[model samples]
Target: MVSSDDTYLSMRGGVSRGIRRMGGEEIYKESQDCRILNALSIGDVVVTSAGNLPANKIFHGTVIDWQLELFPSKKIIQKVVHDCLIKANHYGYKTIVFPLLGTGAGCLNKQIAWEIMLKQIIMDLSTIHQTLIEVVITLYGRETLSDLNWKFFINEMQAKWEIK
Candidate 1:
């Protein structure tokens, strides 16, 4: 199933938005031949050797770069998310997983990031092969989940898709 990682949240008093750390293990690339590869980027393509992974193709999507804004403008985030979906569709991927964009050192507010993400997903749903493609958001920390705004954003997003 598509899911996010559990994160440890540090809270002080009643306020949110504090330090966060790893709370779960990552899924190793599976050992099965991939049916397709989709690179979602407007820049150079990159490839790395994974000695034992089963997937034959690896897609390098330059969704974010350090030269770019750490907390990119909302429009850019939306564009990149849309681009990822389009590229996946272009390559006929039926299932895809994405980490929360711009939440790392990028330091964008989680609520804003999620809002843009959901908007892009909703826009793409009616256009792509909706039944075949699945989008998964991987959360890397539990502490990050304390944002009530983000929780509300997720609820609204799920409401739009009836996809709880």
Candidate 2:
């Protein structure tokens, strides 16, 4: 899954840019897909076929809209992440990968973004006892974000789920 701006334009930067750079032609063309008729609002999620990528699907969440006047909200981030998980379950998917929602083009602080994303993941997973859903959060940065020990933080959260 990737965080996309509300407009879903051919964003030449951020997550979209990386995918494009890696030859995600089908994913790129979803911008013109009729199902995406209008600009998405914050927290909205749209699923599309992964172009040439190996994944079965791509979940594009509207976690930010840098062009808009509205500031990114923690609530919006939580909503998008949770919604994407639900959507994945709807498709009978056992696993879904997500990127830090607001850290890239959203211009959000990396630490805050990670905290918000991890918290939302934990909360959602807590309520999902019906089935085992594996979730992965990946960070792709040009420069090291040494401030947060992400591996340690994620493992700490994993331990809380140890007995559940």
List TM-scores for all candidates, in order.
0.54, 0.79
* lDDT string, candidate 1, 38-135, tens digits: 32232222222223334222332233344332334576566656655665566666765655655554566777777777777877887756543577
Q: Write the per-residue lDDT of candidate 2 for residues 78-164, one digit (tens) a residue.
A: 888888888887788778888777677677777777788888878877777524368877777654547667777777777876733
Best of the candidates, TM-score? 2
Against the unseen true structure, what C-alpha lDDT does each candidate score? 0.46, 0.71
Question: On a 0 to 100 scale, what is the lDDT of residue 98 in model 2?
Answer: 81
Report the CA-based lDDT of candidate 1 relative to the real structure: 0.46
- Model 2: residue 77 alpha-carbon error in angstroms: 0.9
Candidate 2 residue 110 Cα shift, in angstroms, is: 1.2
Query: Best candidate per lDDT, number?
Result: 2
